[model samples]
Target: MFVLLITALIKYANVPDDIPARLAAARLPELVPPSSLLYLRVFMLAINLWAIVLKLQMIEDKVIFHSPESQLPRRVEIRLSGFMWCSFFTFQAWALQTFYLAGALASSMSAVYGTPDLGARLPVALWFAFEVSFAVAVLTSFIVKYVLIPRKVQNGASVAGFFGLPDLLMHNCNTLFMALELLFADLPVLLSHFPLAALWGLFYVVFSWGWLARHGVCWYEFLDPSLPKAIVMHSVVLGVLGVFFAIGAALAAGAATISSPYVRIALVLVGVASVARTGLITGIPEPPVGAKKE
Candidate 1:
């Protein structure tokens, strides 16, 4: 995460001043009007920020409850939990991506639509960074909620107790909202771009391996590449999961065309059944060590 932030900062700092003018001159269709895009970015940013705040509050509450005087029988600590970490990373990615997108759109509006702005414009590279990051964020959020969380539940893990309603809405429900937005809200997401999600996952895997090499510790147990077959098996499983998620998103988008209520219901049922079948074959993951039971 720090690496991503520093890279974004360096990229933003090096942006050429006239890049927006050049982009404007390229005659890019205002497929989405600048003002509308700005509004959407702002909305996404706000929601993601709220999610972050809620997450912090959850952490704080847990800490308070586990204080020495609380006399709690066994406090469930989630600070290092995979679900918590995944949520944190997803929120950060979404927030930063939204911020960068908002800035880029604002700059574009100023250059192309003669809208007033506070300062300089962002370069195309920064825009690309933000867009790709946003795509990665959406994919990560979907995989964590659908693949990781459900697997944990099925394996008798007390994953749900670590999160409250707000967290659930932010981490789980927001993925669905993002998918719907991509399908119905005319966002920039496309089927061809789905591979980028897998690329992001590959990058993360490499990054995690590097971190383990340096720190002699693994952030996620499943990602401990040190074991003889761990890296190979983990990489294969993640690749397959990424492809499955991408296909699911594409199918959901395609399903938007079926206007009939009964057909939609049938499609949804089929989708659920397919997910169940996959889960049964793969088996849900057990709670990580240190996960407290209810």
Candidate 2:
């Protein structure tokens, strides 16, 4: 499934002739400083890697509790265990974000140290990944906070007790990092990338079906294969992702027009007010544009 994702994405990706110029957008005002931005991404990349691996190590081979179609308690055991990491939307979003951030860092370095041809070649992987990951990250944060966490709380699990450090980081920090990227990276979010984002969500949806057929469990109840409403739920998921992509694109477009770096940062933070409130994630202070490189 993962192979298919890469092949399809690369096979269909459109890399413009001016790709290097587009990828270099972050360096114009040098607003956040590419080194600073890349370091922040590296920080996110490390956290995501550690948290996801830790999550998988704990859940990988264990029998998972069913939270699917039936009115069963979350503790109700079922045939719901296999590749635990692949079973989650948050994990996948984090994975995608991590992958894209890595690619961005490498691409930036290639542009700095490698020839023009080498730099042009690198954005092929990043172009699609950035757009899809951005929307998915945004969608994950919204759903986890407003939907999944609330649902868990309603299920008699104390919010704090239900999640550990890893869960908290993946669900909350993923979107916050993407929001930071939007603010400082100066990467344009093309509305044309909508189809690529949809394809990404669809791949996961289908992969869930395959996993259901093989292991007989779904990590999410709304994606339960046995439920009649599952189709509607799936549609809603894709629809919401589309909405997020559109919003991100609009925000990126508007941010591009603003010449004042402070005002632009304020504009982006306000646009993603939900993620912006976090003390450490979105709330971490952006370095002043003209400050000495850290």
Candidate that scores best on lDDT: 2
lDDT of each: 0.47, 0.67
Q: What C-alpha RMSD separates each model from the true structure?
A: 9.7, 9.2
**Global lDDT of model 2:** 0.67
Where model 1 places Cα greater than 4 Å from the true spot, the runs are: 1-34, 60-88, 108-123, 161-166, 173-199, 206-221, 226-228, 237-294
TM per candidate: 0.52, 0.79
Per-residue lDDT over 1-294 for candidate 2, one digit per residue giving the tens place of the 0 to 100 score: 443465456655665766555554563346566556656666877887887777766542334455544543334344223346557777787887887777766655654556333344456556667777889887877776677655654554334422567776777677777777777675778898798788888888888778667656666777775676778988998899999999889878877577777886776666566642233453323334554321
Error of 1 at 82 (Å): 16
Query: Measured by C-alpha RMSD in angstroms, how accurate is candidate 2?
Result: 9.2
Question: How displaced is residue 190 in candidate 2, in Å?
Answer: 1.6
CA shift of 3, model 2, Å: 7.2
